[model samples]
Target chain A: MPIIQINLVEGRDDKVVSECVREVARTVSRTLDAPLASVRVMVNVIKPQFFAVGDVTKAESAAQKDKS
Target chain B: MPIIQINLVEGRDDKVVSECVREVARTVSRTLDAPLASVRVMVNVIKPQFFAVGDVTKAESAAQKDKS
Candidate 1:
């Protein structure tokens, strides 16, 4: 059995989340040659502060001027 | 930053899920030597019919007599 999970920022509505879940599940089933019934998908929506890149939370980075 | 997602059967109460998430995040943070703030966890609760082993869905197999 294959279980897939996607992590992204929170904002999408129910419709968008549902569509994303379906697409992810379909892709996993197709790529692994597994039965559609055997694939499970979980979507994790996180607040911007909970995720970071390069020692700076995405929320903090977004607030500051472009460092590059 | 590390994101962890766990896939398991549904029916767990909110408390169980929260504790699971915290433990997972803690382990990931410690093992990776990453900041605790940088770890994110997502729990995916799936239906029995959606996960299978040996080409048979768990739900179906459970309904039948033990084959072993």
Candidate 2:
């Protein structure tokens, strides 16, 4: 069984997050020739400060006014 | 830009991994009404030992003979 976890900045709607998980799991199952049931998808929405992009913490948005 | 990283057990076909990345990115962009260019997807494949599910390291597959 293959478990997939997606880590991204917080602020996503439930619908979008759920769909992304299902799609990723489906694609992997089909491409790897594994049973769909064998794949699992997990979503981890972290504070922007938890992630950094070129020395800038993406999680900063969680505490800032910017929503990007 | 939002970067999406998918961490999973290794041994998946290239086609599947690529598709999963694109699909997750697309879904998040559409559902969140964010620019497609702002969403980034990154995949980190561990050696199984880095991950544990119910006392079993999923990455153990990287060293074991059984492919789960």
Residue A57 accuracy (lDDT) in model 1: 50
DockQ of each: 0.06, 0.35
Candidate 1, chain B, TM-score (2 decimals): 0.80
Clashes of 1: 0
Candidate 1: list runs displaced more than 4 Å: A1-12, A15-68, B65-68
Runs of candidate 2 with Cα error greater than 4 angstroms are: A59-68, B1-68
Candidate 2, residues B1-68, lDDT tens digits: the string is 55565666666667787876777677767755779988887777766566776776765544465654
lDDT of 2 at B50: 68
Top candidate (TM-score): 2
Best by lDDT: 1
Worst 10 residues of 1 chain A by lDDT: A49-58
Under CAPRI classification, how is model 1 graded? Answer: incorrect
N/CA/C clash count, model 2: 15
What lDDT tens digits, residue by residue, belong to model 1 across residues A1-68?
89886787666797989998999889888999999899989877765544444334555566785654
